[model samples]
Target: MYHSGRLGIMDDGQSTVLHDSPLSQFADQTAEFLRYHVLSAVKLLEFRRIDWELVGRLGQVDRLQQLLGEKFRLVLDCDAPQYYELALEFHSTFQYIHIFNMTLPQFAMATGFYTQQEVAKPVFVSLLRGVMKKQQDHCVMKEDLARFWVTIATSPFSNNMVASDIRDPLYRFVHKILAATLIGRHEDDNKVNHHSLFCLMCMVEGRPANLASIFAWSMTRPKKGGGKSRMFGGPYITWLADNLGVFVDYPVDRMHTGPALSLMELKSFQQAGIITCDTPPAWSSIVEGPQVQPPPGSAADAAMQAAIPS
Candidate 1:
């Protein structure tokens, strides 16, 4: 029923299923993509900007707009010709539905959204639904997020992934810990950190690829709380750069993935833009960073406190 019938685009909104039509193929591909990719309940409308950008790039949007402008009123105009009536409605929903046949790269490029070859992280889905604007090319950056990151690493930030003592904003941000960028008084700062989904999850290929990697910046460490126990074991610092992985980078080395970096090496990588601010491995409960827990009275609370390394 959903084939050419319900959509109102191809066959005048009449309930007829043409099993081998272009519209049917487009719908099938779209449904298959949605079924496997699992956008986590985001509506199809969320990706309309991508299709708009695609047609814009193809230089065919003018014709599309012309069709829409002239034909759309036929849905409502009481005295309009029957040939251009409600049966042939023109809507953005149809636009979104019709264009899902584009490849993943084509669909993802305009929004700077992507995923790894393996491992379907849910965060990426959230971001795809969130970034409403279109970025030009996958290699290009939005700039403001980059500036905001530089500002953040000026020192000490928080994330649930890294230890409280490891206040390296670079470590936190790169690891997806900071969640969103800070936007505050920055009259003198060149880039006022405006936090949004578009900049946060950008997976542009290159050095400092995503917002996470761009902010992989750190500052000199301080032995805070007068404690001397050192932190260890981030993606081990020796894994092949080609095999190593971060949030959006592909060819993930899952087991050797954490970057085994500590305060000193993190400072070094921060300068080179290899690491980012800290975020807890929200996926791993075996590890802990900053988190909200129940009041400190239950046995569970006691266990959590004991798990904290000295």
Candidate 2:
């Protein structure tokens, strides 16, 4: 029923719809395929290294027998507790970067991105643009990584709807999804995505790119059956407080800049369009009383717990 429609390849079992069209043939080189595969792998390997760099260092994992059994495609048997556990461990442990880089690039190479001299340059340019766009969409838009960190470190998380404590469950839930989402996917939004670079150009007296916020709201997660809540301890925060402060002098005491800026100071900054705080009820007003006692662990402890799930 289906035919390759080219030099003589055909498959009888496939539907007539399986016939490859010229669009299908020519579309393989674009970023859609690469973005899908890459982001899927990124989700699988959240907090892990990107694949393009790894392919040069190691061989790919191709043998399915180890994870899937002799049948290779059989559904996992619930009775097989050991294999079930193995499957969980496998999915949790596997970093899928290599699979993406190797497979997608192979498609691009076939389309002459890596071969034909004339088309290769444009293909490479397009590929770079796609990657840059994606990276911009995922990360916080600031003048630099430093500002990105500061914004996240000070963002509100918990309010009366969730808990009084700054380190509330809703906050963690939101950030966990956010960190993972940004870690996995990229998109093309020339506005906020391009902020840090544009600011950099401005610093050096170069022509700045048009920049805007990535979204109407700050980085936060929605509540169940309701509104959204902010998150803390984002990558930008950690990087800014620890690494970026050496240059910016943002006064990151108490592990973040929150302590440095009083409620009045924050309001003034917001009015000046220098920084935007999450809308009220402000973090202070959310709590009924004084601050909660520190949990069994400190912020450092929470970071470790996040790294390896129980």
Candidate 3:
């Protein structure tokens, strides 16, 4: 659904399904690629921008079709008379449904808006039912909600069996921790860190061929407060690179995957326009010519604390 339906321009604002269609086989293949090769929920969420960028790359229906030839069968419905009406209906529901539904109850719970549970439940349910009715009246709402609910429940971010098979797991069997952070943020307001996802997009844009590899690198390290002791893994480093927009052209030892970048290489990477260095950290004493400072609360600090345990 994500790769073939959501990413495809032809399927935008259209009915997206996973069963019994020419696109089904291609959807299955895309699912397999994510399952067999991708790492964790964090990696998946980190790559969400790439998904959007891919759609942007093929803005027009014909262009998308050309780029994704034989990958799926897509029939664009540009002339569908119901499109405008359905769009208006969906927008109206989006505006009013939250007043009585989970938004209010969840907000109350989260923000202490209401201390009494009994008062919130019935109100929330009543609002949710009304919203559901409105959604049913609009074809777009029905389709969009179905797609959103399906992915929300059964996506790689879920704890279901579908996510466990992914090659490199994180958080010791848990799912959706880091991924949900960004996904939830995106669903709510459309901006997250601004630094993180943007950097990931730029890196992938810089070297499209190394996307999967970089994704793999990102999964190797779980995010902070991940309930795991170890820190600064391969994937985390990659994420840091994207988050900071730092060009790390380190020496690629046989065992090391571009680890230990030299000062000159770092400068060259910056100079080559691989990354935009905005207010990069400045160093006065240059024993190494360009010193690399570890991020706060990193693995080294954690290890040192463990050693002392004071």
Candidate 4:
């Protein structure tokens, strides 16, 4: 009866065999066994080396996301080095899919992953500090650092996070870069400093007051007398002045007419106690010899004489 509709004596014997076999119950039990084994397999891989092929196949069966989600949660909860080791592996393996296929924020939402704030802001800051410290050892690549900076700056959760969360550590990192730039270690050191400054600006978005203070402090730091040369600080100050319109409502090309126009604007602010500028203009040499007459009634012109040191 199971195979053919034959109702002969042989068929009756086959039907009796089928009835006694409990095939339906056996099929259900086998399915249950496979499900258990698959879940076990995924769990085992979490603590050991991941088999991507197997994981991919399991994903095809709609288990990869759940398994990886569990692993990610474990990573957030555990401080054990093993968890990090496995987490790093998973991140590297699936970063393309995780980053491009769906943004990290979206992935976090879909998978119920914790935001950095939920993971603890201090912990996140500490991790950033650790990475920055390691960069001093030449262990981190500029590109990797840039990517990390961009992600933090653009990510929804991170973009809105309080600046105080990472302010001290970020200031420390900028100070380190300043020290390196002062030392003039390599030809590309200025570029590195510039890139670092840019990243810092990005990280401080939405807080113009804080950003202004940071730029003021950076530009005004006392320089050692009789130094060979300083490439980073002076140029950075000028860059900030030149790009002031980008962050504030100040006119763009309005301050670029005179040779020392930008410097005068900064000096006016410095005198007004709005900003400070201890370091002289980097382009002083080029702007010397002639005090280009400032435009009539120009505030920058009026401040120009007081701005320049004798």
User: What's the lDDT for residue 227 in model 1?
Assistant: 23
Among all candidates shown, the one with the greatest lDDT: 4
Q: Score every model by TM-score.
A: 0.17, 0.17, 0.15, 0.18
Candidate 2 off by > 4 Å: 1-95, 99-145, 155-173, 176-310
Clash number for each model: 23, 3, 3, 0
lDDT of 2 by residue, 199-279 (tens): 322222222111111110122111111112112212222332233233243222211111111112334323423223555
Poorest lDDT segment (10 consecutive residues) of candidate 3: 71-80
Cα displacement (angstroms), candidate 4, residue 20, comes to 43
Candidate 4 stretches with Cα past 4 Å from truth are: 1-85, 97-101, 108-170, 174-199, 205-310
RMSD of each: 25.2, 25.2, 24.8, 29.7
lDDT of each: 0.26, 0.24, 0.25, 0.28
- Flag regions of model 3 displaced more than 4 Å: 1-59, 62-206, 221-310
lDDT of 3 by residue, 242-267 (tens): 33343333211211121221112223
Instruction: Show where candidate 1 strays beyond 4 Å.
Output: 1-310
Q: Report the number of backbone clashes for model 3.
A: 3
TM-score of 3: 0.15
